[model samples]
Target: MITDDLIVKMTEFNAGDPKRIQHFIKVYEFAHVIGAKEGLDENTLRILDIASVMHDIGIRPSEEKYGRCDGKLQEREGPAYAREMLAMFSDVTETEIDRVCFLIAHHHTYENVEGLDYRILLEADFLVNAMEDELKKDAIITFRDKVFRTKTGLHLINTMFGLCSI
Candidate 1:
């Protein structure tokens, strides 16, 4: 479980850019709303929130090292950092840590979503990304056809953002 202290620390870690921290918070909020609608277990929802916060932790490093910030690089650099950052939480089991780490590691790729929790986290991230990218008037259609698959996630996307058609 991510404590308030842990969140504070993480948000403060990257003082140079608050947008990254805020982005994670938005993703975490979105994940929480959809996770509840999906009826995820308490433990799983906690993991999802933690994963949501850590998902973009890789961007800064990727920018510094490779000049390119993207999903693959995020996946590549996220896990170990998540582990290091999450070490403060004594309640988090090894399995929880690993699962959350895996989610963060692959949050951007979206190839294999094993459960609703993961799928919702992906959707939440997409919701934020969509907001950032001027939604193609066709996004709702594309999202319906290609992206918004899970009922809870789709509901959040459409209800909060707008209707993304199917």
Candidate 2:
């Protein structure tokens, strides 16, 4: 129920911004698929879902305040909103909320990533971003090499971008 609630909250938060809402939803779905394929446990999968949905939550505030939404600003501002949103649900544990917030804050960092949830979240975000940005094959390949870790994430990238051997 909290997961469903989060989705609705995210949708409401990005109201009138179809692009942002769609982006987060796509990222959430991709992360779910990849996490399942990777055999992530329930807890990690839940965190990945939350992080994916709230990862770019800082964008609106960042754009409003700074007239732009960059990775750093998103990372810097996201956790507070994530925390506030997560607090609305009583079933979400404190540790779980903290971990989700941490993942949201570091989702764009891409370095020193320590967990499956984090890696999948990053991969899911990149998958959507590559398509939305219309990145070249070279760039996608570079990102696959540089950022991808899990087998499922790599496979999705290869398949989505036609880098796989058929």
Candidate 3:
């Protein structure tokens, strides 16, 4: 399966860096949970899974080129690396590749989201990032209001970050 292949390749691509490996793996896991709970069809789920694993594929290259891996750099350098890594698999269709690449390119852009897959990727990455980055309550609430739309994604953000007084 491409998911398995992606895991292996992502792991290899992030070798010797447990933090990077764990970040992608955690993002993939959250994306899997939210995608399934949100009832994404098989095709969308597959693309989400692939995109989650390969979302940060540009981090290394960005850091190498610009000495930092900010959102713009990742967005700029990610699609090409993602395309190359995805090309190693034969089952992934051109449409799938295009869609995943699109999601990766826009994952950091919160406004003008165009699809469920894109929204979920942002939610999933934010879910992991909230904890990884130790985001504060105000930022979490602001993002929850501005970015999150799906029921499942919003619920996860609220519960995970204690946005609501329960």
For each candidate, what TM-score against the reference? 0.90, 0.96, 0.96
Computed on alpha carbons, the lDDT of every model, listed in order, comes to 0.77, 0.89, 0.90
TM-score of 2: 0.96
Q: Model 2: per-residue lDDT, tens digit, 1-166?
A: 5767888999999889999999999999999999999999998888888888888999998998899989999889888988998888888889998999898888888789899999899999999999999999999998888899888888888998999532
Count of residue pairs whose backbone atoms collide, per candidate: 2, 0, 0
Candidate 3: regions farther than 4 A off: none
Query: Where does model 1 exceed 4 Å of error?
Result: 1-3
TM-score of 1: 0.90
lDDT of 1 by residue, 75-116 (tens): 898788889877877778899899988887777765666877
Ordered list by lDDT, greatest first: 3, 2, 1
The all-Cα superposition gives candidate 3 an RMSD in Å to the true structure of 1.4
- Residue-wise lDDT of candidate 3 within 32-143, one digit each (tens)? 9999999999999999999999999989999889999999889989999999988889889999999999988998998899888999999999999988989889988888
